[model samples]
Target chain A: MSASGKIVIALDGMGGDNAPAMVVAGADIARQRYPDATFLLFGDEARLRPMVDKTRWLKTACEIVAAADVVTNDDKPSAALRKRRSSSMGMAIDAVAEGKADCVVSAGNTGALLATATVGLRMLPGVRRPALCSFLPTVRGETAMLDLGANMQCDANNLVEFAVMGSVFAKSVLGIDAPTVGLLNVGAEEGKGNETLRDAAAMLRVEDSPVAFHGFVEGNDIGAGVVDVVVTDGFTGNVALKTIEGTAKLYTGFVRQAFKTSTLAKVGYVLASSAWKKLGQRADPRRYNGGVFLGLNGVCVKSHGGTDALGFANALGVAVDLVKYHFSDKVVEELNRLRQALGEVPAAAAGGVAGAG
Target chain B: MSASGKIVIALDGMGGDNAPAMVVAGADIARQRYPDATFLLFGDEARLRPMVDKTRWLKTACEIVAAADVVTNDDKPSAALRKRRSSSMGMAIDAVAEGKADCVVSAGNTGALLATATVGLRMLPGVRRPALCSFLPTVRGETAMLDLGANMQCDANNLVEFAVMGSVFAKSVLGIDAPTVGLLNVGAEEGKGNETLRDAAAMLRVEDSPVAFHGFVEGNDIGAGVVDVVVTDGFTGNVALKTIEGTAKLYTGFVRQAFKTSTLAKVGYVLASSAWKKLGQRADPRRYNGGVFLGLNGVCVKSHGGTDALGFANALGVAVDLVKYHFSDKVVEELNRLRQALGEVPAAAAGGVAGAG
Candidate 1:
């Protein structure tokens, strides 16, 4: 009966490669599946009406909140957010800040979305910077890799914050308590890699670590699932992310080609067609589409530029789940608690434990 | 007409992951395949005697250059080469330097192999750094990617030298005349990535580049076969190489799990078994095993650490082919000619190329 029982997710309609269409399609699916969910689509009134008309159920199920403009992926974040206050990304984040929505979602410029959420929704107490978190399917299980591309230049403090935020996100969202945090480096040995990673590893290994700090893990171990949370600077994280994406595409292409090269192979292909399709779907980036930029005050998701409708739907689904679980507030409260526990901050009233906006 | 019609490559009996056994196996295969080919196995008299005994026909067919000790993978290159002067790696390189063997083959420590070859056989004139080159199989075909993990930190000059040596190796050995060289960066744009890559990209675009410089390429394009040669520093290259290996392993594993999930899947699995196996073999690192450290005075090939007989054999095969074409000399001459043509060096005769060593 209350809004708390039904997640209110504000979708940035003018974001992503297929923008309003994908956003409307995803909303349509979500509304059809979950009656309790309410989506407030933010964008230009004229463009969205045509898109929502196709969805056929937005009149009663979802609302289109008119916004002045949209943020282009190529524009600088600070400049775009400053120039266009009513931009979809900014409006969606504002909705969360104003208590009109529990979470904000954007497939727009990742940097702009992150900046808007950080500035608009306001970070949880004691959380210096928000980090992006996503799952990397490793041999053991899915491990959360953080700061996927949030801060380009991270110091020891930044990494510590990332570890705390990532750990909290993994625990609250993925249902994993005390997730093992690892410092991603060129090697597993303690002192291997660039200065930043080495310093971060040392900071993470402290007895008072906010999370379960594991020793260093190598690039290969990311897929092997050696640790639950892998933390690194955005530069390396971006490269690692793209590298994995490229490799997956390459392997899938090679496998398809290999199967098509022979006459007998064609017969085998028909037999294994369903199985192969499932394998292809499993490897599909759409299933794990949106990469959340955590540490910010609000929930923001960045989808791949090449994402299809399924990917858009997955992004929306993640947003809905995150809002319903009150993911942002949980992360902030966990970090503040850890900070106070570690004597980094004075004991605050109510212990800063609060629900998501 | 003998099977040894081409240049004779000597194998170090005490080198590689499966030394003696793998070394002997590869040599036997090479000898049987190439009627004119001969292998000079070198190692400890006691340990190698049994391995030699097993291949008695290979004994008369291939020569044994006796050495007393072995070089461990973890040993420091300079210290190992200095203290163990009669070690298998040192002696193997000496054979080439002395003209008793055209090239030395070893799957031992890459650092040790590189050091021995650089110190013992000497580097070509004007070559500041040697690159480890490997064939990266792309969708179009196999392209050469160099500096896989030889020089860890490289300057602009070192990258230029790497480009020239890599171009020559790919052209002379792989038969790609005037190979198109691409500088590997985070993005394809000229000004993308960090300072090192941007500077290297500029250096590569100059008129003095010995090969056909095709500007920049991303990690994805490395195996897309868009360029004949992809050049980068050892650190990034190593990461890229391992990422590809890890992804392939992960994808294949996923496929296996998918097939084993159900009886219907099992039926499909059996039907597609041959196609899957063919795909695995084609993507196998063994078939494209061995990385050649170009710019060394003599050819030094570094096989994978996990290599078996087949992979080792591929390394030996590469070494023999390199020697037959006098790969090192061509690189040396090209460097000298480029230096003179670019007015970076005084006019020198063809014989003066040896002085660069």
Candidate 2:
């Protein structure tokens, strides 16, 4: 495949439990799947050669960009960003910032990536802080849930910006025109939710929202899919995400144990293997691997570092799609419009002031 | 079941999915299951008679208290409390308030029940607002997650009160001694959570905390059983509860589809029936039906209104247990001690605050 007219994504190869092998395998899969997309793998070249030799696609379609070391899960976010200058994640982000790659993908450390990306790419013109946004598969449909874990704390203005950015991301990537944005609160009533969301709801109600702002949504309503964007402060959003993941795991574990309890059940399991695999595939970690860090100057996709080859492949696909869709530009434009609407004052203004927004 | 030695629990026979039938059946089950318990069924004598006639044990162990009216699920909370003066739920609570029954158990409209109990029984001294607290099963153990769908908005003081009340309830009812009270934040760091939690954390860090106070806990930590009492403002707490419930439903649904996929799986399904049933029983909504409204002067157990006989029975058991364990007096005393330690200033010193409990 020719490099011309192709989007280049810098993939942090030395991240995740599967690490170099999964990254290499995923890169090969992406190269075979999307001939128009090229991957630049950032990791130690010596460790990657074995997998590179095994795949024909990797030889021509993908390229290896050598980095000295890798970031470990044990490292603190600040220390890793500061001390690990030659780490794969740091180099991958640098590649995007230096104009060598259109976007960056990493499964390494979410906090480290957020910190480094914030320092490396810098926030956009009107963006105060970036939010980690992901598409949650809800009963109503798929919707964008913003600040899934990025900022631990946020004022009402921060949430307002999150709504705007989430709206644009959904419109551009999810292809939802005039997406309905909802503030994740305790209830759908305007009188519901915390003080931060209550004040933010007032802003969302009257202001010229970038998206179709649809009042407030409760946690159960998240799956009901009343809106395309669910805006929340990082703390609540993070808890919501983890709770969903944990509950899913626990329920599935119980079912698996149930199925293996009897000999007759073992026979049923054999016959049902294919259908079970299909269902598992539908709920696979790979299918929803990439979550974008919005409100930055450039695109940055963070995949779960604990994923396998399929997950890494999905992350790369997300990076390529994000670059093609120009995700960052859309988010930046929305942020600018929102800032212009709210004036030059800090977005954190109305958090303590209640209805100031 | 002799009346003198048995614990007496009043049940709202007109509440829940099947109304008098489920209530009557549940009361019978509880009576037979625990010989030392008696039930007072409060509902229309005509409607409850046929259901009560179905069981022999209920005839002798349960007494029907005549109530002329019913509180419909769709009625407005305030209107239900005002207009339905002789409703089953109202009568059951009244029995407790008048010291005729040790506890009140109702599978009635949650909002209406909460409002009625608050107005009729009144808040305990130093209890600014009451919270609906329940236990959500997690991987490590059950988490004491509270204010689940209670007050939509809560301030720092309200959170502090919830922590104290939840701790006391857990200790007295759940038999968890010196429960580690944790303020649920986005992160475990002291300064991590939102402003309300941050302020609450500061107050919780004081030497005079009513329970064994841990600094902070995250969403995943809830399932990890790192803390005995997980405290948060109502908005986040409600969202977290619903999110876990929704995820559990989604996962279990997927697993059921997995089992019924093919012919051989049919055999496995039959063999696994026992294990599946056991697992199902563990995750059954009926088993976890009741939620206690803490901070009130009397024991009020609210079960899901749309519940089966098994669920209603669980609710009755919860009420009986709370009464036997003296949940109300213990929690109220803890709240008073906490308030005194914090140097409970008059309402004037506390200034303007919404949901100040």
Candidate 3:
């Protein structure tokens, strides 16, 4: 925030399928909600200037910073961070790290974005690794799932950290005061999973634990809206998340095919277009575009790489909401509560805010 | 099969939600498909005789065997196998081991049924563990996935065994020649997944491998019909399977809600009733009831415990198909080919067919 009460955002240009144009246009849409917000955009000056010039309020609100390098999808995360500090994604994150902006938004390669942000803005104290949390509309309402591929393999301790992170996310972003958290397992029974899951369950079962633990839940529970926060290792979480998206696609394809079978069916589809339109909104991937990177020192939102401008705008909205919620501080408080419940306090001198310079 | 050309089947009459009535009624329906089949029904004769008498041909087709005990849902699988040998499930599997029946069908406890059948009927020569394979309808056609909750943690070799078993399943049951088998992973790239998956892929990539290896596939690939057979460890496979089921249900619920929003939609729904009926058939879970136990000495099918006679009959149908296809023998052939592809043949003296006495 500035002296005049403006929210400053750092934009990663030259990221995603449609880069500078989508980034600039999305910023324009987002500023309508946060009129006092300004953008410190990073990308090629030549490529970004025209896109910025076309927007009404954007031209006055944006400042474009030129960066020659770019992060490709194939580059390994750690390698990308060590090598591409001058890249657009890196510079955008640097603005946040420097406290030049309150948050950063990028539709870049997910691994690169995660790596760069983790290295530049860094992690909050007492957090081992950051988790990627996203939402999907369930039967009851929207449910949040965490570690959506940030850490492929997580142990018992790592899982507990993720649970705390997810709890804070459910509270801050999803607006749930006391969100129920469930450990993803193969079966609902207590004795169903491996040692790590059992150990994690034991930890979460504590009476004063940070989260309201709902015990173990199976794969079906994710869509059944069984819990507000579904926690698991990144590998399983990623698989389940993608599986849900694929299934939604498959079911939509089936419905479309069913409606195309005959003229009467087609007429019925048109006559009931309003109802189907409501469904279209329900299943729209664009509505859930932002994946919040939890436990970071600053707000960093990862937009879906292939999403359109509207999706990009939604990502900006997410970053703004996260900024309003002070997500990182909430995470630290939750972690403290969790540590207290576990009968110990986090180590001293590491500091509760940023652990690194 | 006997000299009279009848396919002998063993039925666990005291299994599943509906018990003896569902079991007997299902047998009658299955007999209509395979008119040359007879059942050795295992349960109390007092209860089975009345149901057999209700159907015209069931009385002539079924011979009720008095098994005094029954296996309950909560019993641990191995413990149940040891203690309940005279139970209906045990007696039914016993018929197959004794070669008095060609195969068995049980809608009992999945773990108990898998345990009893594996122990009683035994594994084919060179098989370490048996996998449970099931089918789901896809965009291209039906795709088979194995280790659907059988082996929770699979080694590289275990996964390879599953691949060969799944390949055989695709050929014998799904009727695909030289089926393209895919190993499930977090990403499609060769570098993705853990060591077990990478090692399994290396083995499957052998030029003379039994299955046509499609490399790595993501969770979405299962519903996308990207390959003929999808092979994964039981834990991940179970979660993905249930997730798919959950997603379909969620989508169906959303569609129903959409259609109910307006009177015009209700009218259109009635007018396009036939199309919706076809869609209903496509989505019917009973249409895909049976989960086949692969690499077992003889065929065994696990019907969903909650299913009605129709679903039970579908499972019976699956067993008959496996019998006609000579599934176990085909699995042996596939395993032999895989062994050849792997360079060193399996050690001798295990016998070529059934491993147990």
On TM-score, the candidate that comes out on top is 3
What is the lDDT ranking, best to worst? 3, 2, 1
Candidate 1: clashing residue pairs, number:
14
lDDT of 1 by residue, A1-357 (tens): 145588777888888888878778877776776677788889988988877877755546678889987789788777766845688878888888888876777778876777777788667666777777787666676778877666656887788788887887677556787899888765676646667677766666655556798877777777777788888766557666666777777777877777777766677667666777777777767777768877666666666656666677777666666666677677776666666655667655425444422
Question: For residues B224-285, could you state the per-residue lDDT of candidate 3 as single tens digits?
Answer: 99999999988888988999998898998999899999999887777677778878888788
TM-score quality measure for candidate 1: 0.87
Cα error of candidate 1 at position A349, Å: 12
Docking class for candidate 2? acceptable
Off by over 4 Å in 3: A1-5, A346-357, B1-5, B346-357
Find the candidate with the highest lDDT and give its number. 3
Greater-DockQ candidate between 2 and 3: 3
- lDDT per residue for candidate 1 within B135-242, as digits (tens), equals 877777678887877766688778778888778778766788789888876567565666777777776665655668898777778656788888887766766676
lDDT (tens digit, per residue) of candidate 2 on B89-201: 89888887888788888888888899998887888777788899888666665668788877866888888888988887777656788889888777776657678888888
Clashing pairs in 2: A264-B268, A265-B268, A268-B264, A268-B265, B158-B357
DockQ of prediction 1:
0.39
iRMS per model in Å? 2.2, 2.5, 1.0
For candidate 3 chain A, the 10 contiguous residues with the lowest summed lDDT are: A346-355
Model 1 chain B: weakest 10-residue lDDT segment is: B1-10
- lDDT values for all models: 0.74, 0.78, 0.87
